[model samples]
Target: MSDSNTTDFTNPSTFILLGIPGLEAVHVWISIPFSVIYAIAVLGNLTILFIVKLEPSLHEPMYYFLCMLAITDLVLSTSTLPKILSIFWFNSREIDFNACLTQVYFIQCFAAIESGILAAMALDRYVAICHPLRHSTILTKPLVAKIGLAVLLRNGIVVMPYPFLLMRWSYCRTNIIPEPYCVHIAVVKLACSDTRVNSYYGLFVLFFVLGLDVIFIAISYMQILRAIFILPTKDARLKTFLTCGSHLCAIVIFYIPSVIYSLIYRFGQNFPQHVHVLLGNMHFLLPPMLNPIIYGMKTKQIRGRLLGLVTR
Candidate 1:
């Protein structure tokens, strides 16, 4: 509250998200593809949502998780793309500190939630294939509701605090964040205050939250594979593999780039800033846009229902 302690926070407190770092000359051109991707991600995910909700057969656990995933993807893309496109198309890069913090929070929240949903879906498949008799009883509607709530709460409890922690830091620098969007560490690094706690807790969440989700998903697959290999019939094994293919694809698309991006942000001190920025952008963009398409193609019931809706 005192003028002595408060440095001038308004001069450049507004961050200029220098999208793509050095590629500012033709941001409009860049906006074209990003615009297209954002549009598809939103509309495609929404379509998946609508179909899942309206169809009675999709009221089951797997489809419910799919709906959850679709909703997460929609929010994840919505949280960042508007500002990013604004920067790209209109050169409107000025963002309020609190607003940027809000963006970072929701973006991180939905991203963590998505990873959680994927882990749940893997478990759903595990129940379905590995324990066929118990699958329905185990993943009932009530249990699905609980799982969804747990994912929401788990992510909210973990990720929502980081932005507040970020807000506590004194940011007296150029206020120009180098990434295309307001990433957590990228924004935190600009603060004049010591960010050791932020950095340390970030690693904690990375390993404890997101990293644990990835590990559990891998473990679920290992169990699912083990179960499949021991099945009595070749046809049964092949069917089980097909059932899980969409999930495997979704996991690979999301986590591979995500892990690389996180590792580079934390450890690749010598890597170029633009490389970090680009990988971060792709981590959010590609998976959301492609996930719905993967399900529509791979799952017969979804594909058939999607086609029926499309024909109408």
Candidate 2:
């Protein structure tokens, strides 16, 4: 073990990522599944973007949100997965201090942006279902543009301080990070200086951005369900419910792991270190890999276009 007193107290030139703690021996084996998932996520999200762009009928509010989501997922995963694979494959774990901070920013920013998009999608569905006649008017091109911009700006501003705050801290502790990726909390925990502000701000971002989005999505879906049930015809109700099926799956895959990971990180002191690390990684990995698959299978228009592309 290296002595902390001997190390430079200021932000070190690089931080070492341990990549799944106790699973060092089988990192190569672990990389196999992660590599496969990353590939599918890349291909699936690219396909969604391509098909949506090609299909003029998909030029609607919902698909626009989906496009934004695809772009966000691409950035979110790309920010961390390449570095993680480097650690798993080559035992290359040293991340430059600046690069680590950049990774931390993108990972958190895109995640919050994703949550915002989901809320916007839920509102879109609510309008489309409960107020079908005004759906087009309510979710016009300009309005959708504004919503996207607002999501970007909100998350960007919220996460922008992480790097700056981190830079101000003194990392007198060991530079080794037990997880494959650099997150705000994980990086901040290394600081020997007072980190109460970092912790409190992280909690604020969690609840303010992600928490509010989840609540909004839930309320929108409740309204959507109520509207669907009142439609009187079974076929109409089923069709309307199916319209929300994909987004609901996206929400589940995205938020469930995230909540679980956050809980484990904060409270699960008795749990193995790998559990926390795995959950954190899963929070990032599962949504990107599963979202396109969910939307592709559930959204008929995209599915049809995908089929047409494959057949052609």
Candidate 3:
């Protein structure tokens, strides 16, 4: 560890992660739940992917979108949880500067990708419900591939500048990060140089990428609901709502924590630091852990496939 008085301002070798500032004493205890949740998340997402791949009947636009969601959830969680558990269990807190930047890139990039996937999924539902006759013609294999490519390119291009932006600044302030893993704002704020560009760019990415995704998702759902209400039978309406229930749950689980965390981080100066840390962690953790369970329980095809896999 570099001494406070003698640390190099131009560049630092490593940064120390505090693993949730106020709850340091309970870090080991905290590792238990985090580990359990991470395990479940990994297993659940992998199972979803595996089932979708093996079950020929599951090869459809909707299931392909679900597979994309599962992969995004897996990447998003795996990027942070292992290091978090290491911090808690082994007291391994120091992270190399370049590695920290890489972590930040992956975390932010995949988060944006997940948002895009959700938007795509919403569109899938909208098309399936609102334009059932043209669903196959519209979301064909090539089109789905193109949408996936676009999602990757959009997020990858947007987040690629983060590491370069951070690297340009000198870390004269301090190398102590208050959270378990490297985040864009948390790491950038440590720079002793002017960070307004970084800050503004971060906000732009948030609003431009995630905000637009939310808007598109909301519009898609509105159209879906309108179409549902036009159905003649109550049973048809009930079935349509049930079909969308899992996706609605996933969106709420993914976005609510993220919005709350972003709001508190930017505006709630009086809020406890630990609260911010917990919310940030949950923003990444909860959706991955719960998404599979929600889909498994709500989607009959997945549930049946899971049962067959378990029995066999």
Candidate 4:
């Protein structure tokens, strides 16, 4: 810590987070469910990773894309859970301004990359189902690896500027944040400086990173649907739909709550603080807990291996 003489208290170096404000009485109770979800998310994603690696037959392009999704889920869950649990269990809410920005960076980066991975997965499905013969040629192992790397790098490079942008704005107002975590606009609201520039940049990034991915993913699914309907045999169409079912469920699980939260955050000014806080936490936690479950229930190969692993 800097000496008191060396620091300006007006523009504070530390900020306090009010974790799920208005629910302090049941924080410990909330922690139970949160802990269970976090454990499942971590264990489930790790299981998918290990099963993919152990089963050589699962080393196809599709499974590789699933692996990327699982890795992103793991990263996403880790970024949110530790700090949140600390808030819930121990009431440790003081975070360095720099650390808060760092957490937001990873939170946003992993989220954008997850969206990118979903788009890539959609593309892989489109190629496989629509152009089966060319699927092998188009989605080679090296190509899949390249796609994964591109998603990671794209989000990492894009989100790198955010913390720097926030640094430019002087935070002269209250140092208390109302949410459990350092969300962008939430943190920005605490800044006494003009925040229009930061807000605009956030919107731009949101549209470019997540919005663009949504468009591509939607397009991929449309093409897949068109191709599926054109198939001559009922069995063939059913098979195609089944294969896509898991990814579609995953997309819905991730994006629906995300979009809802974004809408509420931007426009639901009349909503209660707890409403915003609860939604924010759920938006991060739900997909991680459900993604592997969706895959296990819908994807046959994953189900088979999961069963074998459980029994063994």
Candidate 5:
């Protein structure tokens, strides 16, 4: 076969990633900071998981969901960090097609799972605050376990079509992806064939995964708030609100940036390049770091358990 025919038979099997724009000049050096942050994110989430598991007192539904959230954070950070480090530190921006697809799949899965976990946490708060008499009956051990499994399965199914769709495309010539990690949109942009199908699927998944999850969480909190206002005693109202404060903060941090990002990318056609990378990292990194901090700071029980485990 001729050179053109040989090349035509198969799509390009590798891609180059153009990381953070201005920082490209110092990619190797910039990676040092990212490496430290990634290490902290991983270690922090793992610590929370360990603390939740070791504390027999934390065997409640709330802590169980917290542990699940920690696990999801680990997955999210792991999905993007190593590849980012490779691109920045080692100048190894070339990713095999399978590896890229694997990264995209895991990133989507982790993100979707995180959303579902957050919604579950909100529901737990709702029941504990709004229906204290029935909290135990509603959020039983088996029920929490089932919800956790459902989160994983739902996210897996939602993201399953992403990698499959990617595999069908032909990369004619474009191979450079303008992002730090193998984001789904960036991957689809390289495909030579029409990507309307993939784009529509992504939109549908985003609406269901992030939009539906956020709406459900908000509705759960709204009910909790309504119940809180009806409490006859001022102290009772204060206590319930205090108990939910950390979760409220976490939900805001996790979802606001995501919503803002979607809006900007959709409307701001010429948004700065740095903004995309920054928002991407923030959405992935901040929630994991803040979640543990929020729980540790707001909940005395978690702090006491962590201190006891450390001193022992």
Candidate 6:
């Protein structure tokens, strides 16, 4: 249990991730369900990405966002599921500190990218529906590229500190992460040294980065609603609302669970770890799996074109 008692890091060159402690007894049983979900998640996202790439007509802004979403989902799910499945099937959950941090880094990056993409998509909807006359001029290809680059840079800077802070902390003592994967906060929490800085940074991210993005999304939707009501033609209003409906649903499904999990983990106590694990998997999987469906089902042009391409 002490720092010196555990095997030396230099010799072993790996640390065991004591995954889902109480449930380790049922690793085999867990594998059955976990494998199924993992397979479906990866396959589902890949299909979306394939359809987006093959369909030439989906080269526009909206489908581009959907493609990006699929890519992000694949990264996000890959970050954790392989390790999780290892624990389930092979009973091997060892992950070196460096590897663990690397996983966390990528997960944070993709999640941040997805958030930025959501905001961009929301803005796209606002323009397409509310500012119909000027939508084309506003969301030009160059502008979209600029927005994507900005999002990547912003998230990179924010998540860059996490791994550095983690490296500074000596975790020779207890290496068992409570959850299945190497979550940023969860990994930091296990450190023997003081984690005040990590906690502070985590708070900053929760409130400032994720919090601000959600707020902006909400405001954008509000403006969208106001614009919708003012449209004189009933058919036009319905069509406009339908266009944004799928995205709106995806946003709620994605953001609400994230916000709720952050709040529950930070403030709420006496909650079960299993609940956290389940929610974490959902958070990683749901957005990617649903995003393609949302965009494909809602967008008439993309759907029709994709179907045509498939048939031809």
Best by lDDT: 3
Return whichever of 4 and 6 wins on TM-score: 4
Off by over 4 Å in 4: 1-8
Q: List the global CA lDDT of all models.
A: 0.86, 0.91, 0.92, 0.87, 0.84, 0.77
> Model 4, 1-312: lDDT tens per residue?
332223345567877888887998899999999999999999989988898999998999989988888888898889888988999999898889889999889899998998999999999899988899998899999999999999999999989988888887776557788888887778888776788888788888889998999999989988999999999999989987988888888899889999899899879999998998888888889998899888878878888988998899
Q: How accurate is candidate 3 locally (lDDT)?
A: 0.92
Which candidate model has the greater TM-score, 4 or 5? 4
TM-scores for all predictions: 0.93, 0.96, 0.97, 0.95, 0.93, 0.89
lDDT of 1 by residue, 193-223 (tens): 8899998888888887788998898899899
The superposed Cα distance between candidate 1 and the true structure at residue 208, in angstroms, equals 1.5
What range of 10 consecutive residues in model 5 has the weakest lDDT sum?
1-10
- The C-alpha local distance difference test score for the whole of candidate 2 amounts to 0.91
Clashes of 3: 0
For candidate 3, lDDT tens digit of each residue in 1-312?
853534555688899998998998999999999999999999999999999999999999888888988899999999999999999999899999999999999999999999999999998999999999999999998999899889999999999999999999998878888899999989987898999999899989989999999999999988988999999999999988888899999999989998889889989999999999999999999999999999999999999999998899
**Model 1 stretches astray by more than 4 angstroms:** 1-13, 267-271
Cα lDDT tens digits for candidate 2, 1-312: 342335655668888889998899999999999999899999999999999899999999999999999999999889989998999999898888999999999999999999999999999999999999999999999999999999999999999999999999999877988899898888988899999998899889988999899899989988988888899899989988988889889999999898788788778999999888888999999999999999999888998998987899
Cα RMSD of predicted structure 2: 1.6
Cα lDDT tens digits, model 6, 213-241, are: 78888888899999998989999789878
Better of 1 and 5 by TM-score: 1
Poorest lDDT segment (10 consecutive residues) of candidate 3? 2-11
Which sections of candidate 6 miss by over 4 Å?
Answer: 1-13, 305-312
lDDT of 4: 0.87
